[model samples]
Target: MNKLLVLICSGALLSACAGTNIVSLESSVKQLKDLRDHDRDGVIEAREKCDNTVLGASIDNYGCGTRKTLIEPLKVDVKFAHNSYEIPSSAYSQIQRLADFLNKNAELQVLIEGHTSKVGSVELNQRLSKNRAKAVENVLVENFNIATERVSSVGYGFERLADPADTEVAHSTNRRIMAELSHTVSVDDMIWTIYTVDQTQ
Candidate 1:
């Protein structure tokens, strides 16, 4: 009776260990210890992504997932008044489109910049520039439901010129808003699922 009970307990423990999947970093560390204790740096270690899967995704050595590339920023020229931060009615639909695009790209991040013409005091121009950026930020936040943390606003204050001319066309064109997607991607955010069942054991 004692022998039989011991056998049953051992079987249950084995099954529990076999079915474990470590998804977190700490959990993964323990999982790795349980899996590759005998040969720490062996070929099996290379194949551990299959042994303890976290995201159920295609993974590399570092355990990342499949990547979805987005054409971030979806930029358009948003123009405002010379000294005003108010978004004009004529540009409403255009900004709306950008907001709509931002909604669709939750995984992405952005930087919204406001520009102005070279016809104002530097201090006032800076203020106006910041306000213009804020104006775009408000629209994106209010209408699109995009998280404010995911968006950052800046004011160029006529520092960056598109046309670099004194003409109305140049000034009008410079008075614009631009949003760009973050250039960096988080390497740790991906879910990598590896299928090395044959190699793991």
Candidate 2:
């Protein structure tokens, strides 16, 4: 009976070890699978693992998932009065469009940058520019109810002139507010489960 008990205990220990080994093996395979199928396409494409086609190819964090593509960043400019931060009636339509766009795209991040024409004291212009940026931010956050975290403001006083020429058109262009967008989509973000194979059978 003692021998029988010892054999039973040994069998249980061996079973536990086997279970641990299987789990460890599965974890290792998962890690490798993440690297290989970042896009999660069942069939591994040559472009996914490594790039040897183009000389001096820039690969992403993952060894696979490479494609030559061009995309334009989203940007919009809002013109302001010479010394005021108030939103003009003419700008209402543009602002409405921008607000609508932001509402539809919840994942987008925006930066509101304000500028001033070279018309006043540097300190005053800086304050005015900052106010203008804040005004736009307020419109988005208060009226449109956009989350504050998704929007930010900054001022560039009399600097970064859109039109460096000393002309009315140039000054008008210089006194403006710009909204820049930032969006990031990783390979994993675009990933989908193509198919699954049952190996248990």
Candidate 3:
């Protein structure tokens, strides 16, 4: 009777060991499957902050942005007074944001082109526009500490205007300084990649 009891106990122990082995094997299999998925996807699991990423695209350099390409330069328009070179506080926020971008893209350069309305004479308008552009450039270099070498100022002198009208609203569009980025950006280097993605926006 004692031998029979001992044999039954041994049988129960064998069953438990077999069950544990099966569970361990299952867990290992699951881990392998997860690894396989990560490898097969080929999509980068992590994203970089500086990257202008597109749908299902991964950044090339970790912090510098995506490995893809840009189509056009990022243009920053700095509007101004009719004939004044003063930097307005209202436009400061946009400048501040631009300063941040400039800091990130150290390799980048900009040409700050100034414009004016037809209110002034050709010579006076050209001078005023140049000064206005220089004024903004001064702030960007002095306050933002952007490399002076990376920036150049030009005066179109009423040659280019979104609106060339006699009205104040139209003239306002002409009185502006615009920054054209030296480098082009890929479709991915943008935050909202889609055109009017946010309906409410």
What is residue 68's positional error in candidate 1, in angstroms? 12
Evaluate residue 30 in candidate 1 and report its C-alpha lDDT on the 0 to 100 scale.
29
lDDT (tens digit, per residue) of candidate 2 on 69-188 = 443346778888878899787876777777777786787768889999988899998999999999998988998888999899999898888888988899899898988664444332
Give the Cα error of residue 181 in candidate 2, in Å: 2.0
Q: Give the TM-score of candidate 1.
A: 0.53
What's model 3's overall lDDT?
A: 0.68
State each model's CA lDDT, in order: 0.68, 0.70, 0.68
For model 3, residues 145-179, the per-residue Cα lDDT tens digits are 98899777888898887796789998888888888
Superposed by TM-score, candidate 2 places the C-alpha of residue 42 at a distance from the truth, in angstroms, of 22
Worst 10 residues of 2 by lDDT: 21-30
The parts of candidate 3 lying over 4 Å away from their true place are 1-73, 182-201
CA error at residue 173 for candidate 1, angstroms: 1.1
User: Candidate 1 at 43: error in angstroms?
Assistant: 35
RMSD of 3: 10.4
Worst 10 residues of 1 by lDDT: 1-10
Off by over 4 Å in 1: 1-73, 182-201
Query: Which candidate leads the pack in TM-score?
Result: 3
